[model samples]
Target: MPAGIRLFLGYAIAILVLIGLSLRFVIDQAISMPVSPLGVVVMALLAYTIFTTTLVLQRKEAARGLAIGLASLTIPGVPLAWFTFAAGPLGIVLAGLTALLAVALLRGLTGQRTREWLSEP
Candidate 1:
């Protein structure tokens, strides 16, 4: 399988498992399956994966962009997973921090000056 497809499948499976676990929590409590905050985080990551795949599939030279984008996604995703699991306002802070970190990592990987320019007033 192509690298992007492999990534997509792995993340997709992970997302499904997370959702099932969230639902199990509700079921155990005998309550309706309200959306868990963790579910939102997982969904966001899954969306990121899908978006990256779309970018790769649309490019003639997918390697350059695909590798950079995937690295960008992973850079903060690892931390975001921890933050989201912790829950509450701390989770929000973690998500924002993770996004900022991801942008920096992406800039480094792509050799793009967007971050430098954005830092200017």
Candidate 2:
């Protein structure tokens, strides 16, 4: 699988499982099957934003797409914040930090196909 796909799935699945564990262990509640519908939506949006920016970068709108990608990194934090309540704002901060790392990781994935993608043509 592509790194982007792998990375996305890794984060998605980890977050889901974490959601379960957080509810069970941290929040002292039973695991809800779907957890949160909004979580699914947030993941979808984050995935869309990540891949589309990559698509745009490959299509020659490199700078713009990269900026969008960087800006969008914080998207995942929203769902992480929403679903995991015990962590408070710290969870949000860490998620945003994770997202920043994800931006570079994603850039590595997207840029792997073309070193020139982020450079002036």
Residue-pair clashes per prediction, in order, are: 0, 0
The true-versus-predicted C-alpha distance at residue 22 of model 1, in Å, is 9.5
Model 2 residue pairs with clashes: none
Cα lDDT tens digits, model 2, 1-121, are 3444345445545645655554444323224445556556555655655565455445444534444454455567656764676457777677666667567556654655443444444
lDDT score for candidate 2 against the true structure: 0.52
Give one digit per residue, the lDDT tens place, for model 1 in 60-84.
2443455465555556575666566
For candidate 1, what is the lDDT? 0.52
Poorest lDDT segment (10 consecutive residues) of candidate 2: 24-33
lDDT of each: 0.52, 0.52
